[model samples]
Target: MGIMEILMIIIPTTLLWAAPLIFTALGGTFSERSGVVNIGLEGLMVIGAFTAIVFNLTFVDVFGAWTPWVSLLAAMAVGALFSLIHAVASITFRANQTVSGVAINLLAAGVALFLVKYIYGKGQTDIIQRGFSKIDIPILSDIPIIGPLFFSNTYYTSFVAIFFAVVAWYVIYKTKFGLRLRAVGEHPMAADTMGINVTKMRYYGVLISGALGGIGGGVYAQAISSDFGHATISGQGFMALAAMIFGKWHPLGAMGAAIFFGFAQSLSIIGSSLPFLENIPNVYLLIAPYVLTIIALTGFIGRADAPKASGVPYIKGSR
Candidate 1:
């Protein structure tokens, strides 16, 4: 394909792939911003994907065309509930945040697979009967290059992700709750002295993180994977984490970083078709996003600051 033709195909694919990352990374932003390090986003996403797929498969007839959307809600609820494990372990019990997160990831994987076997009598759930379809925006889709690149044949969740990122940014930076969340993250003792409830803010952050992460998984399953299995979620959760770090814990920044990763991911599939990349090794293209992630986290992009009290257990009266 010519450059313009290639561009047409690549942009939509990139955005489609980026949608999940954007949501999950935003979830990470919420958790980390509240001074809790949630490394279990992967597990949360796995549960979300599995729950969404199973719900959609089981209820497609009843929900008709809305099955996917409803399944997303189910996924979100499950994701939040599962995240409570991490919240309790890290916040209430004051366990090592990283260790707790790792446990969450392992637990999510084991439970999801076991449930798949128990419920489906197999290793994976049936493919969803219906999945999210692409649609063009009304007037904007009629625009020139921009329309074809962004508004045409795109998943609605892509726009929703961007909108939510903006909303998350507003909530984290502009609102009263956001102020308290930040205060707790930067200095829990100071926040406690100011009468803000440190544990409460942390819980709020973790719950929101779970909700968004679950939604991300649901969107990926409904729009991309179209099924639930051991491999359904793979490692997108970790990529989202990388995006969170790449973006310096800012929602908009995370979205941008996700888009970049999405672009790299898309290249793996489309590279074979593009004239310039046609000769490149598939291995290189497949690993590009991950390689970029490792590079981003290694300070090659300069040091990124995290919330000061992140991963630190807040003891109410301790100096």
Candidate 2:
């Protein structure tokens, strides 16, 4: 293919792969910014994927073209509800936050698998008839080089993901709730003294994470996989966590990191098609994204600092 054609293909594919990561990483940003260590993002994503596939399969006939979108809502609701287990354990009962998150991951996987078997009598669900499709933006897709590379043949979810990243940045840095969320995460005792309701803020943070994470999973299922399976999520959630840390807990930063990772992921799948990369071994291509993730997390981008009170449960009057 010519360079322009290749660019068009690669850029759109990267966005497709990046959209879910953006959502998940943004979710991580919210949870971490509020001082809760959300190790269960992977589990939350699995729950989302499963719920989305099942709902889409069941309702595609009823909802028609809107099935996938409606399924995302179902995933979001279920994800939020499932995350309450973590919130109650970590915030209400003062359990170790890490342990609570891990439990959520384990519980979500087991519950999802069990429900899948019980509902389908099989390991994976059948593909839905109405998954997301790429669309060329009306006038924008016709605007020369930039249009073809960015707007042509793009999933709507990709734009939504980018839009939400900007919204996330504003919500975290410019809003009153954002200020209180940061305050609670940085110093729960101080926030509590200021009548910030530290517990309530943390709960809100975790719930938001769950909702976004669920959307991430749903997007992956409907736009990429078209079905749910044991490997549906794979390690996308951990990769998103890596993006959050690599971005230094900033929303726009995480979105940029996710796009980078998405590019790496797209290369792994499309490398053989490119003349320069075709000579490289397939194993290296497959492992590039993971290697890059480790590099990003291991100080390749300088020191990344977590919130001061992150992972620490707050007792009402404790010092």
Candidate 3:
């Protein structure tokens, strides 16, 4: 394929793949920034993917093209509802956040698989016909080189994600609430002395992570898999978490990192389709992303000093 043709497909596909990661990674940023370590993002994503597919299949004929939007709402709601378990365990009950998050992941996996088997009578849900469509900017799409690489054939959700990345950056850096959130993460006792409710902020952070993470998985199902299966969200949430760490927990940085991973994934998939690359083993490309995740995490561990109190439950008297 020519450069333009490859760009036309790869760019849009990368953006499509990146959307869910962007949202989920940003959600992780919120969670970790507020002293709650959420490893249950994987579970939240599966819940979202399943709920979105179910909503899409149930409402496709009635809602038509609006099914994707409705599914997004369903995903967010389900994600938040499910995350209540994690919230209660970590924030209220003072359980180990890592253990709690692991529990959530296992529970979500079992539940999602059971539903797929019992309700669908198979391993997967029916495919969705209604999904988000690409939007082409009239003037920008006509430009050469950068046009197809950036503007042309862009999904609406991609732009929405870009907007959210900017908004997230502003909200985290520019808002008073952000200050309180950081305070809660840094020193809960100090924040409490300052009249900030650390508990409430933690809850909000986890809940927001859940909701956004749900949207991330839902968007992925709509675009990439076009269906919900037990495997639909497998490893994706973890990948997003890796992206968050890879980006040093910054919103825009995480967005860029997630998009980079998306491009890597897209390139791998496309490589097998190309004439020359068809000879290479697909297994190598398939494992590249995870391998990169490991390298990033290990290499940056020293530099990525998470929030001071992350994963630590705050106690009134213990401190």
Candidate 4:
């Protein structure tokens, strides 16, 4: 295929795949920025995928074209509920945050698998028919090559992701709530002295992460996977966490990193379809993004830092 052809196919596919990662990374940004570490993102996504699939299957007949939109909200709610498991453990009980997150991952996976097996009589759900459809923008998609590349019909979730990114950036930089949230993440004691509720801020942060992570998983399922299965989420949460760290916990930065990883994922599948890539091993392609994540975490790009208070649960009235 020519470069243009690749661009046309690659760009849309990359954005579609990356949408979940970008949103999930941004969700991580909220939690980590507010001084809580959320390693349970993987679990949150799995829960989201299950919930989305359930909603899509249940409502598609009634909702018709509106299924994906309604299901997205359902995904967000279920996701937030699932996240509360981690929050109660980490924030309220003062358990090891990392351990709590790991528990969530295992719990979500187990619960989802069991439910799927019981209901579907298998390890996966029936694939949903309704999904986000690509729509070409009127004049914008018809311009030049770049138009088709940028303005053509694409995953609605990607558009929502971009919108969320911009909003996240604004909320982080411009809002008073943002300042307090960052303060709680960076220096809870100092923020407490300023009359800010550190506990509340952290809770809000993590809850938002769960909500977004769920939507992220749901979006991924509807747009790509089409089914709720144990393997559907498959490490996407960690990829999002890595993307968040890779992007320095900034919304726009996370977006860029997510897009990069998305393209990496696309490369794995799309490569096999090309004449030149037919000979390359698929295993190497599958592992490339993860390898890049490791390199990024190891400071190949530069010094990477997280909130100083991250992973440290707060005990009321204790230092």
lDDT of 4 by residue, 81-145 (tens): 99988888888888998999999999999998999888779877998999887888777778897
- Lowest-scoring 10 consecutive residues by lDDT in candidate 2? 285-294
As a whole number from 0 to 100, the lDDT of residue 30 in candidate 1 is 95
Off by over 4 Å in 4: 275-284
Candidate with the larger lDDT of 3 and 4: 4
lDDT of 2 by residue, 34-60 (tens): 899999999999999999999999988
Q: In lDDT terms, which candidate is top?
A: 1
TM-score of each: 0.97, 0.96, 0.92, 0.95
Residue 213 CA displacement from its true place in model 4, Å: 0.3
RMSD in angstroms between candidate 4 and the native structure over all alpha carbons: 1.6
In model 4, residue pairs whose N, Cα or C atoms come closer than 3 Å (at least 3 residues apart or on different chains), thus clashing, are: 135-153, 136-153
Q: Tell me the lDDT of model 2 at 106.
A: 87
lDDT of each: 0.92, 0.90, 0.86, 0.88
**True-structure lDDT of candidate 2:** 0.90
TM-score of 4: 0.95
Q: What is the per-residue lDDT of model 3 for residues 202-257, given as tens digits with 9 covering 90 to 100? A: 99889889998899988988878898876788788998998888888889988998
lDDT, model 2, position 126? 95
Backbone clashes (count) for model 2: 0
What are the RMSD figures for all models against the true structure?
Answer: 1.3, 1.4, 2.1, 1.6
Clashes of each: 0, 0, 0, 2
